[model samples]
Target: MRGDSLFGDLVRAHRRRLGMTQEELADRAGVSVRSIGKWEAGQVAAPRIGTLRALADAFTLTGDARDEFLTSSALDDITPAQLPLDPPVFTGRERELAQLSASGDGTIIRVVSGTAGVGKTTLAVRWAHRVRHRFPDGQLYVNLRGFGPTGPPLPPGDALRGLLDGLGVPPQRVPADVEARAALYRSALAGRRLLILLDNAADAEQVRPLLPGAPGCVVVVTSRDRLAGLAVTDGAQLLLLDVLGTDAARSLLARRIGADRVRAEPRAADEIATACAGLPLALAIVAARAAAHPAFTLAAVAAELRTSRLDVLAGPDPAADARAVFSWSYRKLRPAAARLFRLLGLHPGVASIDALASIAALPPDRVRALLAELVQANLVDEPQPGRFACHDLLRAYARDLSDRLDSPSSRREAVVRLLDHYLHTALAADRLLKPHRGLGPRRPATHAPGVTPTPLADSDDAMTWFGAEHPILPAVADLAEESGLHTYVWWLAWAVLTYHERRWDRRDWIRWQMRAVAAAERARDPHFQAVSHYNVGYALCELGDLAPAHGHLNTALAFYEKLGNLAGMAKVHLNLGIIARRRTDYTRAIDEAETALALYRKDSDPVGEARATNNIGWCYLTMGDYTRALDHCRRAVAVHEAAGNHMGAGHSWDSVGTAHLRLGNPTEAAACYRRSLAAFRSERDRQYEAIALAHLGDAEEAAGRPRAAHEAWHRSLAIFTEIDHPDAGEVRAKLASREVPPFSLRQQIDRRP
Candidate 1:
């Protein structure tokens, strides 16, 4: 008979001999009738170890027959000559297994722990298989069903009874008392070298009674937790199983699906491994699917798996079978912990402790304790220090539970409070960092005090805050849009804009500007919309995209005119002048700048007037009118100084220095550059500092001081490199043409001056 027909014949013959129908076997095994039929008919050739054990129990198959059936099922297609197995093909766990195994001799109770699908069971099975020969008596295996939907874990007394019966103790002879049964179990394995494998043991209490006290025996326990109590109390060796190495995952794939197939589809195989995230259970499921369907390419399977993680995780197994594994773990969580786990799925991104606390509105310390419980249950993952994220599959499961457990209004309120927390904190930071950029009228604050609505102390604190929170900002923006919280979206967008501008992040500038514009449009707020359009246009001009810049700027100008906002109109015209200067339309640039300057003077907006005057100087410089440029730049500098704006003063002085350089006045240019550097440093603007340094280098060279010029150029280059500026390449080119002085020489210049 063929392999399938032979397996079917054996299953049928075994069932009939045991006087059990397929339905009876299915009921006893806690599986479906169809699944049992498929197994008997060989349509589904391999049953899980759990199903096989249930069948064996129902059949009353004991002694050699039971052992032979289990051993054959475990062997699968391997020949009798290779029946013992070589190291059981362990992957991603050499060091851990070796360390655990080397923890002295005797009946070492080693516990392997990790999050779900992290290969805890695989390591235990592999380690047990390696030392099986050392235990000459026999090897015993049991799935405690610790994390499944069926119920609580199999009681220690029951597991002990199975082990006793497996070692030849008849059911009638088994003791009813738990302690007596445990004692009997220890006696059964006395002086025998038996290797006991307890897969998915719930806790130390469940496992302690089952351990054989005989010095020659060894026991391996696998669980989805650290089992710290077991280590502290029982001195059990503990091995924390992490994700597999990339190469080992590839090797696992190659083993199941031919090496040639893996090589032919290397990229897809890599993607499959990454999608599985080095989890053994996931990889095994994926590889098994690939093996069972020879016609389905690995890429096709990988693509499908990426779209639906839970669906792929279920694999060819029935939903019931997959839930059996997950529900067991879920059942073990406390009521509050389980609720928190489901609610956490509502979080928009990787969860921080504060954000989680804010969403739950619980004390930080209390929420942290609950998170620990969920972590212990393996329902959540604490991947890095103070950061927690759930697997995509687990997150989806949690989301489903959230919907089932929480009211719609409760979920909405939780999400709203989270958004409010982020918005209020961002506003606070914005106020502290850019106090001059007035955010018209303040909205009524609704968030509570524990949320801590305050900004950091300095620029460094601001940078750190933005950097740490950057990953979640976009998701927060998305949530704001979804929740129809238009004001929150636009204001948050505006606040983040300053950080992006300070860092010269063109991509983020464009992204947030677009979001701000959309939010403004949704709110029908014309003034805010005009501001968004203007800033976005300015960014486009900076990026050298002129046509779109002109279009957006013109749209913004029209909006400002309609709203009769003269300040907004003047700012738009000034930006337009800058754009025209970049396009080399000096005449149009001069015209726009002059008009903006006149309007700013009329409004008595000194800051606006100074900015417009600086633009006028820039236009003249582009047109090769050095005298005219110098006159406007000087006026702009005086106006900026009178306004007490150090940043504006620095820009004006830099322009003045450039005009002096063009006019061949090295001494005047150097003086202007020195003054500009002082202002730029005071403002903490590195970009301007680099420009001033470069100007100083040009003036020094003009004064016939090559060594001093080289020192200045090298200093500027270092600044460029430190800031990751695009101009670093240009600075490098300049450095390569000259014998640059050491940076140490420039550092000592202040002492000499």
Candidate 2:
């Protein structure tokens, strides 16, 4: 702000003219009010590129006004590398990849269409990653969810919003109406050299609005449908991605299992490829099956394929034969492995080895051996180490097998065990993560035989466990709701609340909590209902959907009042304070926080009282009452530290540091921030660690230690980048403003900052 007086002046003037408080601007711009205050007060050298864009949109700045505001702050939008993780074992698509590479110039659309599970999306993603460097501006991607199990195809409007978001358009700047949003989207990408990969498109219509009107961007659309309209109207190059040829199919097997294994049984390999119908999905499963049983000759696998129900792998639909191929592998499994495989079908998404162990009523080591057998048969895929995922088709096949073979009572027992495993393990992990939060009393010897909940070592292990198991939690909760395990539903939701909040997975947070409410209603448990509603409300409030959030919170409050649940009422008041704080109503925030504090005291809940105290400190800090902020935050930190709640202490430490920094005590602030950073790192909370590092950088800079500040910011930037956080842009801007490039910490600090 010292170098950019005009930018600060304009921002302040614009805010005043619009009758906007700093908080209102921050909310609209998706930034913290602290940042807005600094930007307007000229305490910051320049706003981040993302912040500049957000401000422009918040003020509805257009034409020269937008350009002037942007350029004045050196607003250069960062390239968005949004492609998903590359296929770990992509193989046998050289010809298709070459064709895609040679198809058209960078200005054209390419449609890659194939049958289901025939690797259409895989090919598209693989190719996108391959040619990513050609489009220097950025590579963007979106899964349309067409023909996938998760949900329906993504609406064009939502897809466009995703693209615009990736392009760094502020949410406020994105038009409410789809047509306007599409226009804005096109405008944003007009001349950028970018790659847009639209995976699993339902049809041409779903993709049309997302396409850039101008031609510097190349659009790659993958689908089961041909999307002939795109080819007909948009002149999109149609690359009909058929099943892999014989050699490629065998090569895929070799890549997954081993070349020597395939080489030893060349005819068996060719027979296995033929049995798989040249479909990569089938081939992978078959290869996995083969690899798991390395001692089993390829001829044995081929023999099993020949002896299976299907007379031939050839069929009208490739997926149908792939199911047969799946069955062939399934039939060859031992009773335990086969049972484990079919039971896994009950899991909607990924399953950890522990979950599998519980589901099968087996010990972890026994389950691991069974999984190896299944994996060797290619019946399941270990996408990540210790985490298994069956192909969608294979999952359906397994479910079908379970339905036909397993008795109704047995299936129910397995499901109950699985639910018990997830619920109890989730509770344990949450206990480690948020020690201040009250957990249900452990029930002794309740779980069925062979059902063991995974034990985490500490908060760090809790985070790792949560990270691996997040995707499966919702599905488990859904299973609970379906099976009338009503208590499990709400408790499971409660268990993941901390993890979801830390990860900022708002969508799943809201979805799971809402489902919890429904399950509670079915059970007619007032306490469970109130808690679930409160969770939903809290999640919605975080998402900034204030009206509905208020509605849910009010409902939760009413339930708590009726039930005379003092502790529950206190938690509700705490969240109400948060809602009020988000609206810039500091007085109301403090009032609600005090109400929560009193209720917690009445309930004899010191942890809850500490939380309320910390919340009050945060509100005071936001209101610029730094002295009060310091006092309250210091008390909260003491309480948290005494309770051994490092996560809570880390957050309180940050507030303490912020208060110190605002009071011009940079040296003290740096110490507090270092403590905050250490606590978060110990808890393995990457997001908060980054936030502490950023604050530490500010303190170090203010303390006249530029090298330390740069190092702090560099580490902060690394975490933000790894997590794909929006704040990374801001951190980058902070470093750039200080003429510190984000090189290796050693290299950058070795040179003078």
Candidate 3:
């Protein structure tokens, strides 16, 4: 019966049975009374061998009683290995694993935190198994059940008891009081190199009590909650886990199914990775489905996932169901934050604070607080400072919640506010980008309540804003159209057109403009329809699709002529002239340019006047009328400079250079080209800058400065290649052949009035 007792309990009982005090026992064993006290108190798991021998002499034990005591004491030497089975197929987290391992010199308390089903526990367990040798005393693991399916989070006291048990402290010896138990746990771990893994901890409070005060132990706590308190008070290092990357996600899928199967359907594999939103749990669910149904192609699985992400990601276990798992975290949020989370699903992409505020009808500061809570819960991420994004699966989950909980009218209102935010902000940014090019009436200073557009500092700031927000602009336009904000659609397209044209992505420019054309036709707005058609035509010309470009231009011209919009007609004529020149119809180019110039003069627009004049000068240069070309281009340059239109002036100067080159004045040609290049560089017009550089190279070669010509050509080619311009091929050819083409390359005429 006594053999069943732990060594500490046995020592206490036998000493009392013999009617001896701790001091008397210590004297008999030739040890201090403190040592006897420690054994009886259960603070020390087992006494040393010498101490055991001394205790045996002190107790004067023999036979079964003596053998039982020694046997019980010897059992304490067995190292506790409470770690769960190593993750069967751990993937990714290479950086996280290294972070866990690199928590330098001393007691390490690393908190691995992430969203639900992001594989925090797997990463912790995998890393624990890897460095288990360093903690030779033992490795202890406990799941605190923070966001589990069953009960509320495990209490700190209960978690402490479980950890103590794993450390081999008997139930009777473990203290009932949490603080006392914590002391006993730390005492048990003192001087031992152990790895304590507190998995699924609810918060810092749940994990703090279980940490050993001793220096030799390493504690890893994983949770969905950020556990900021633990990091702040306990000096714990945090490793915030994100979803798996493309390569790792694919690899995980391959490992579950077969690599050959994955390789066979790489595109489907990519689609699965994207649809899964890189979440390891969702990926695992997909992998399971694909493995279970060998007859199913990866494409079929990927298609299923696209239609119902959360549904396809569901599993037999409720704990693994993405919807269920996400709900656990969602339920913990406060009312306002939970509502914000729901509304975030309405946002198509990364949203700024003002956009969220407008959608939620809350102030920016209040929205920030709610967003912070969401971020702490790992339901939202600040992808960039002041810009929040949700995971795709989470967005799907949030959208589902919004559909069920929020009213249809409320959702529509929120979408309206969201569109208002983007449209107004984009217009303000556009105004800064092109102060002279007003497509329609000016935007009013007033906005709807709770809708605050982002304030841009200057043109550079405007350019920066567009660069960050361009990818989402088209999506916002789509959202606008879906919400029946038809006018917002074309305006959104027009707002971003200036940015698109100045940048090198002609294909995207054409796509957005086409969408605007459709929206304008649906809205039955002829003016915008004409504008949209004209923009599409301009973009098509840039891409060398001249036939379609000409068609769109003529359609725009007819609409403008019908509306009697002289200014609009002027813009169409200018673009038509550029198309004619591209087709080498010099006569038609001059006629169109003359028509545009007359319209600009009638409209009293100086910028359009200069642009039209420049187009005529280029046409004349193309036609070998060098004297008239020189005269027209010089006047165009003067008007452009006076009007403060650097871009127009640059084009005029390039035209002037071409005329001079045709007139056999290489030195003057080079000077005009350099001036043109400077103007393009000043405006950050990279695409035009490349063209100007090419013109400069031609002038330099004509001037018999082959070395300068090559340098200019090299710089031009680099820029063209960088921007993915179609002319990069021609530049490459010029370099390869070590010769400039005959001055047949005309400067690009202005397509915008």
TM-score on alpha carbons, each prediction: 0.73, 0.56, 0.86
Q: Which ranges of candidate 1 are over 4 A from the true structure?
A: 1-110, 131-144, 154-198, 204-220, 230-324, 442-455, 482-489, 518-525, 602-604, 620-646, 656-724, 741-753
lDDT of 3 at 542: 81
For candidate 1, lDDT tens digit of each residue in 1-753?
Answer: 112434456667887887888887777768788766755654434443455677777777899988876656531321111112343456567788777678466677888877777777667777776666766677887778666555678999899877765776545445577776776577566666777888888877888899886687777788876677888977788777777778988988888788998999999999898887777777878887888899999899899877976567774344223334565677678887887787788777787777777777777778799999877766777876666777655676777778878999877777776777777777666655455564655553567544533347865566667767878888888887788888788888888876776566768879999988898898998988898898889878866778888888998999999988788789889988888888788888989998898888888888888889999998888889999999999999998888777778888998999999999999899999999998877545566688789889889888877777877888988887876767778767877887645547665776485
Instruction: Give the per-residue lDDT of model 2 (tens digit) for 1-753.
Output: 032345568889988888999889988889888767755665444444666788889998999988888876642477899988889888777888888888465468988876556788788888888889889999998988665545567999899878877887655455566886776577577667899999878678998998888879888898766777887898898877666788888888888988989888899999888777677877776776677688889998899776661433335544435554344445556888888888998888888888888888888999899887665444566778998876555666677789989999999999988988888888888878877676545322377777889988887788888888786777777788788788888788788888877776657778888878988898898878888888888888867788899899999999999989898899889989998998999999999999999999999977788889999999999999999999999999999889888888998999999999999999999999999999988867777899999999999999988878998999999988876666889999998888644568786668765
Q: Assess each prediction's global lDDT (C-alpha) against the native.
A: 0.76, 0.81, 0.86
Top candidate on lDDT is 3
Q: Name the runs in model 2 displaced over 4 angstroms.
A: 1-333, 380-389, 441-445, 543-545, 718-733, 739-753
Give residue 437's error in model 2 in angstroms.
1.3
Model 2, C-alpha of 241: deviation from truth (Å): 17
Candidate 1, pairs of clashing residues: 147-328, 147-329, 148-328
How are the candidates ranked when ordered by TM-score, highest leading? 3, 1, 2
Misplaced by over 4 Å in model 3 are 1-78, 89-99, 228-235, 254-270, 287-300, 442-446, 664-667, 701-708, 733-753
Give the TM-score (vs. native) of candidate 2.
0.56
